[model samples]
Target: MLSAVYKSLKKIDTYLFIEQRDDFSKVPEPLLAMFGTAELVTVLNLSTKDRLGIADINKVRAELAEKGFYLQIPPPPENLLKEHLAKLKEQGKLSEKYNK
Candidate 1:
């Protein structure tokens, strides 16, 4: 099925997908408000795609079929410092004062 994809102006990497182009009626008001203005990204043919860059194709299709819309939010930012600390601890390099 063909789906219209829109990028959220207010949130980076956030997208909204709907079955029909220019149709936001299926999307709720609170979600729309949070999404802010939307800019059309592309019209994707889900039938042709087995997977998407970030979102799961099956989940997107299921949500579209059940709710008429699908929302894609960015993944949480990586905690590099926390990861580094864990790595250091694993390597037995982290000081006891810092490990606590």
Candidate 2:
């Protein structure tokens, strides 16, 4: 991952706005991804937003620290079929000739 980051950086010929910071050896990959994806260096770098994200993650971590408390992944909503079929009807795609 570090190598890929370096290779991408070498390809770009401009100031990347990398800030000086302490060691981040203990940070998880998911959290690390946020560093690059959150536009912290470009858009808004308000410390409050980062604090909120960390607070949320800390709550999840605390829940997992419980004995035998497995995290549950909720399934996606399933009631959108009727709505999608309605859209298809409006588009005239629900007809047998159009479906073909």
Q: TM-score for each prediction? A: 0.96, 0.21
Q: Among all windows of ten consecutive residues in candidate 2, which has the lowest summed lDDT?
A: 1-10
**Model 2 lDDT tens row, 1-100:** 0100111222222111221222234345553453433221232232333332212434333443432111223344587877787789888879776453
Model 1, 1-100: lDDT tens digits are 9999999999999999999999999999999999999999999999999899999999999999999999999999999999999999999999999997
Q: How does residue 73 of candidate 2 score in lDDT?
A: 31
| Cα deviation of 27, candidate 2, in Å | 3.5
Model 2 segments beyond 4 Å from truth? 1-22, 28-86, 90-93, 97-100
How many residue pairs collide in each prediction?
Answer: 0, 0
Segments in model 1 whose C-alpha atoms lie over 4 Å from true places: none
RMSD of 1: 0.8
